[model samples]
Target chain A: AQTVTQSQPEMSVQEAETVTLSCTYDTSESDYYLFWYKQPPSRQMILVIRQEAYKQQNATENRFSVNFQKAAKSFSLKISDSQLGDAAMHFCAYSFNFGNEKLTFGTGTRLTIIP
Target chain B: SQTIHQWPATLVQPVGSPLSLECTVEGTSNPNLYWYRQAAGRGLQLLFYSVGIGQISSEVPQNLSASRPQDRQFILSSKKLLLSDSGFYLCAWTGGPGETQYFGPGTRLLVL
Candidate 1:
């Protein structure tokens, strides 16, 4: 069984500033995927960024990036030049490379953009 | 581009009533489909996933059940609704196992 943990329940960042959301997971599998999903007011789960365990380099998508420490079992999301639209509930999810397609997700961190 | 659709953007059902939610994917074939429930202020909980037609894998034991009648159609159902079942239901699909998943606009279900 795998479990994901998001220690922060809520976070706030000023517009145009940067913010980092922490996430950690427990998994015995060596091959896996880590993902960050954002759910805005519309309730649409949008993919923010993804990092493969095999890839030592962190994944970056425009204003979003991740600090993936495989040995530490930590994958954190970093949002640069944050905007009001970035205000949403962010979730960290984990999935094995094979077998079932089910994803285990963390409790989530509610991000608020402070004007 | 591939897309996913979930119906009844919002639903309200009385306790003990039967419930059904439909999800469909377009522009793809034999894609992996999944059903997730997001409770208030919480993250997603994987309820069920299907790799192919008639191949449903349940992740949690609950009042709900899922079926994949067709390659692109997935349905979530329950014989009777429970207050605990009230939450936002999201339908997602991946190109295949281990691939990134794309999600559809979730359906908000309120069991009163």
Candidate 2:
């Protein structure tokens, strides 16, 4: 069994500033994948970024990036130049490389972008 | 490109009623489909997943059941609804293992 943890329940960032959402997971498998998903007010889940456990280099997607420490079992999401649209519920997910490919998600962190 | 569709977008059902949520995928064949439920202010819980037609895997023991009648059609159902079933239901699909799962618009289910 695998579990993901998001210590922060809520976070706020001023517009144009940067914010980091912390995430940790418990998994015995060495090969896996990590993901960050954003759910806005519309209630649509959108993929933000992804990182592979085998890769030491973090994943960056435009204004979003991840600090993935495989040894520490931590994968954190960083949002640079945060916009109002970035205000949403962020979730960290973990999945192994094989099997059913099911994702185990953290409780989630509600992000609020202040003007 | 692949796309997923879930409906009726929003649903309000009375307690003890039945449930049938449908999910369909376009532009792909034999994709892995999944059903997830998100309670209020919470993350997603994987309920069921199917790798192919007539193959369903349940992650938890619950009141719900899922079926894959066709390669691109997945359905989640329950004989009777419970208040606990009230949540946002999301349908997702992935091309293969280790692939990024794409989500549909989701269905907001309210069990009154």
Best by lDDT: 2
Best by DockQ: 2
Q: Assess every candidate by TM-score.
A: 0.97, 0.98
lDDT of each: 0.94, 0.95
Just chain B of model 1: what TM-score?
A: 0.98
Clashing pairs in model 2? none
lDDT tens digits by residue: candidate 1, B6-104: 998999999999988999999999999999999988889899999999999998999999999999999999999999999999999999767899999
| Chain B TM (all candidates) | 0.98, 0.98
For model 2, residues B1-112, the per-residue Cα lDDT tens digits are 8889998999999999999999999999989999999999889999999999999999899999999999999999999999999999999999998899999999999999
What would the per-residue lDDT of candidate 1 be over residues A1-115, giving only the tens digit for each residue?
A: 8999999999999999999999999999899999999989898999999998999999999999999999999999999999999999999999998866578999999999999
TM-score of 1: 0.97
